[model samples]
Target: MSYVDLHCHLLPGLDDGAATYDDTLRHARRLHAEGVRDVACTPHVKRDEFPGVAVREIVERVAHAQRRIAAAGLAIRLHSGAELAHADALLLPASDLERIAQGPADARWLLLECPFDGIDDDFALAAARLRELGFGLLLAHPERSAGLLAGDGLARLRPLLAHGALLQVNVCSLLGNHGLDVQDAAVRLVREGVAFCLASDGHPGSREQTLQLGFHLLLRAGASSTQAYRLTQANPRLLLRDGVTRPLFDVEQRALAAAA
Candidate 1:
């Protein structure tokens, strides 16, 4: 099955991802070769960092990118998305949320960027607020978060899971590119069935964005083919197709995104 990547920085000139249109083309070609047919152009959306990245502009960029990639005869399909900052998610308008949402209009699934520095008290508050505002969250790179990794990591993770947030482990973390700590957390999340899916979280030509290598590394890291396919293919596909996906492979993850 073709892989569907939900957290790719494939759009050029947006955030720290692809730098130019040509860079995007090269990235698309590589992804196509890796059997990735669909990609989400998830640019960073943080008030302090990417303050100028408006939702309307992201849509326009994706539309322009779709045209460019198609003309290049690449089979890759592009979708609009943004790695929304927790601070911004609390204030962005409902209409803007709908525009940058992952799946259909009714399915408000937000790719919430987990803070790399340290997850403060507001992280859970933001997640709960988003859910209350009718948005499902895909928490990015929890394995790398200093807050989640320090002292009883799983214990801290439980509250977020109870809040209906789905964990998205980065592919690079699985391969130990981030460090032993990140790799261990990532593998443990999968083994314990806490992770909801695997994402490239790819930006331009970064090696971590290389899905083929990441998949192989995951295999070497002790994930079976069934787990790999579920993480890379089935779960991601369903999330993009329907906004919310069920845990067909992990019973422990079943409580994710369920209505209270």
Candidate 2:
């Protein structure tokens, strides 16, 4: 079975992902070996850090890299996308926003980075404002946020789902690749059915085998085989269409059954 990665830095030179065309090809081969058929080329759109990265530029570069991937005979498909910074998401002009957005034209979606350094008050306002502008939010690696599920934590995170946002947990975080807190948070989110999907969020230095490891860990950490498919495959494919998220009731009900 193939998987779709909603958040991955497979495109070269835009961020900390692939450095060159060769690097991009290598990442694609690795992803293909791991059974990933589709990947979103999410270069960083953080203005302060990656000020030169533009929506049009990212799209063009992705196209160029895609041609290389095709010519190389890799079966991987790369979709043009960006991981928008909190401030950039709110401040970017309408034209840029339109060009960068994913999903159906009527109901688009954007991947907003949930800062690992810290969470700020403006994060909520950005989510609200973005929703007002008619784009769905798919937060990147929210479980790795520094202040995970603290005093205002669940208060902040629960609203993501309430606002129709999808919380994407990184596969590495689940395997304790980030830290204990992140791993714990990842587990909690999955157990509570709060995590909408699990993504490789693969970058240059990150492990390529996370897809296989993530599937195994998800099964060990409470997800059934069917539920793991939903998290890694079914839910992500819907990300391009209004950031759709379906329930993991199959596993939840199974747990309930076991409890009863």
Candidate 3:
């Protein structure tokens, strides 16, 4: 029953995640005890505020944690990825985008975060641009986004999904740590089968964000054991192995070629 967390902030000094190396070690132990065998260190990449995490920095910190985990005999493995702010996706050049990408080095799964305040009218365009660049989009925590909570929320998300974007929900959202509305949204997304995965989005302060609790909560919310495992493990594993998702639109390789 090995689990993989596709979104987490376990690296120290990168963003609002773990504050130091010691904190990262503690997070690793907790995740290992909770039955997570692999984790993606998905720090923030909002260009205005957090911008993006540096690839070298992520590698260095992950190496440090791996050595410590080996010394402590923990079995957890680390992968690198970023939670891109929608604004950054539009502003960054393709080459710069490549540097901040998260996932296995061979894979191009970019975790994207929508605006918390609201979805910009042009947000869909930004998502399309990323997809055109050949990166698979894994949207992070749409249930927390105010835009997704209001109006025809599900309708608003349809274009992104149609464009082959996958949705990820935070564990905290399922457990009501974020609030009743967010919990409802998370549960609704899970129950409706709209969400492609569940993640800790864990950044050090909440018990509600553990992967183990999330797995059970999904079951309690109506997901069978196998379905829960697919969200937390199999689907993400497939993303890493396949490197690209089914394109939402007719893809023109010219964009990727030009970007390359």
Off by over 4 Å in 2: 207-209, 245-260
Model 2: per-residue lDDT, tens digit, 1-260? Answer: 78888888887777777778787788888887888888888889887888768787878887898899899888988888888888887788877877778877766888889987656777877777887887877888888888776645555755555557777888888989888988988998787766768888888555554465677889888988988888888888876654432343333334333433
Q: Output the TM-score of candidate 2.
A: 0.90
Model 1 residue 110 CA deviation (Å) reads: 0.6
Name the 10 consecutive residues with the lowest summed lDDT in model 2.
244-253
Kindly indicate the candidate among 2 and 3 with the higher lDDT: 2
Model 3 error, position 99 (Å): 2.7
Q: What do the candidate models score in CA lDDT, each in turn?
A: 0.79, 0.77, 0.76
Q: What order do you get sorting by TM-score, best first?
A: 1, 2, 3
Give me the overall lDDT of model 1. Answer: 0.79
TM-scores vs. true structure, each candidate: 0.91, 0.90, 0.87
In candidate 3, what are the lDDT values of residues 21-68, reduced to their tens digit? 777778788888889988887778764666456644766667777788
**Model 1 lDDT per residue over 51-79, tens place:** 66778899999999999999999898898
Judging by TM-score, tell me the better candidate of 1 and 3: 1
Reference-based lDDT, residue 210, model 2? 49
